[model samples]
Target: MPTGVALHDVRGQLFDAAERVLVREGPSALTSRAVTLEAGCAKGVLHRHFADFDDFLAELVRDRVARIDGHAAALRESAGTGTVTDNLTRVLPDLFDPVAVAVVSLVTSRDGLRARLREARPVGVPILTDAATAIASYLTAERELGRIAEDADVGTLAPTLIGAAHMLFADRQGVPPEAEDIGKVVNAVIAGVR
Candidate 1:
């Protein structure tokens, strides 16, 4: 086994490699062996960092949720300056990234994995809900500022837009929307709010 890096660094690398594996090969390819190999670490490295596959999976979900939450928070902070459509367009792609989609796909999959994923639900839900709230708040502020349609139902509309963004990428058979397509959707939603 090769070793030189600090334990925390090694652990971080393994988690990042796990995300790549999950995104590129789906949840089935997320074994400790695969992650260690991808990270160029010794076999025991994964064991040292994670209790077992279940713990590793939970951490992966947690990390992804944290990343999404951070990104959403950043978007909310910058939202005030952009047009409502601009703000939605900026944040939409982050929702559709391969890692994020893979996490959701894994959660909806069969028995054992689904059960393990359920254990992380309490961790994941609030992150997403907070993201939704940030989006809704941005829209509400825009509406108040006379930038968005005065009558726009910011509450329902914001989440629906976020859901649609996720659906575009999650639907495997369907073509995902491009930036322009997303802009169109945001525009339509705004129009409806008007």
Candidate 2:
């Protein structure tokens, strides 16, 4: 935010500001006014774009979910090209970033926001489900190429992997897990499956 700076992609600006606040100050710092001040927009701009603070938060979480989902989808291209651990290590931790964890916590704490999210979907945030599906899809493709063991239970393992990753990320608080740490987790998971 600055003097006389034109607002472009105000939605993205607000979301980015919201993320910075959530990461730097924690979930309690998230508020319409806080986001507007951080984004350098009119105090009312956030309210103007969404029905309420909860709605704004839902959208923010949705945006992050979509971006991470897209990353998982792209993992298909790396199928059979790398070890399963390598491919998963490259992406699973991306799902558990501090901003993402804070957004999820923010949404879950507010019943109204969580309800709106459920109304928009079927259950909890789809980040994990999306990742699981993406991982399963990649595994299936690899199986076809004889990369994965035919006996591997991808259907069961994919979700288990995602859940483990979720725990790993949730435990991080604000500190980001290093790629090596992710590699270790992925290695442990893959060792069980392979």
Candidate 3:
């Protein structure tokens, strides 16, 4: 193992490596050694940056979660412009990207990682829960605009959409569902409220 190699943005490199490992090999293959190897760095480098493997995994999850905040903002912003179904259909692919799906699996499979994440994310499964919240907020904005039914329950609808979408995208051997297929799902879920 090479020591003292100058690697810029080590944390980002390791995280990106971890995501690649997760997406390609699934959670069982994720380890400190795997991450460092994928990053092409000395194993000690990972320890130098993170307290431990679980800590690194937790940070990786938090990093992904922060992305949802940005997506949520953009989804909320598109509340009144496009068709309700179109707005939602566009966001699902992003929210359920290969890395995000693999992260959800990693978090669920690792007891330590899940416990560590509870400090920052006390409720809901890390990425999926946040995605649901984003959907709920977008639906709420639509309801306010009279695009969604006034009586529609955004709370229930949000999770329902997330669960439905998750099933469609989960464990697909890398091939994503067609946009038209996803649009049909979005339409079916929100049809009652539209």
Candidate 4:
């Protein structure tokens, strides 16, 4: 008999497990065995769902990236409500959460994973690229509402903010940056535009 789970939603269970492994041990530790162990499922559980380890990783990345759409919508909805700095400060950490940073490392370190991801995300790194686009869209909304300067270069500003937040959050291992630190960076990035 096969040793594994017959649980519903196994893909979600495995993805969550992989994120835990990524945050706790970084990308090098994210093997299918490690993920199954973290998930408390048998090793073959992963192989059953995915063609291979890289396929699982690519799907994991895509699932996370798809979440950015929801975030982007929420951020855009807040365009006229909060201060631009406050809105951005709140969203940056969400965008650069520990799992996301680890995913970036995973994508960069594994060429096979990168190649697999490129079919859907051909331009930039997976999570970060989608995040930058989300930020840009939010900033554009704010600009249209007269919250940010009409002259604000949202295209340029979005990536700059993402890059800065990525640096701050990426250095902490599994720990997140303080809200104060994130606020400072957000304030600085939007200062010229506001």
lDDT of 3 by residue, 131-193 (tens): 999999999999999998999999999999999999989973758999999999999999999
By TM-score, who's the top model here? 3
Per-residue lDDT for 115 in model 3? 92
Worst 10 residues of 3 by lDDT: 166-175
Worst 10 residues of 1 by lDDT: 120-129
lDDT to native, each model? 0.71, 0.78, 0.93, 0.88
**Count of clashes, each model:** 0, 0, 0, 0
Alpha-carbon error at 13 in model 2, in Å? 0.8
Compared with the true structure, model 3 gives a TM-score of 0.97
Off by over 4 Å in 1: 1-8, 110-131, 144-146, 149-151, 171-176
Using lDDT as the measure, the top candidate is 3
Ranking by TM-score: 3, 4, 2, 1
Query: In candidate 2, what residue range of length 10 has the lowest lDDT sum?
Result: 168-177
lDDT of 3 at 81: 98
Off by over 4 Å in 2: 1-6, 171-174
**Global Cα lDDT for candidate 3:** 0.93
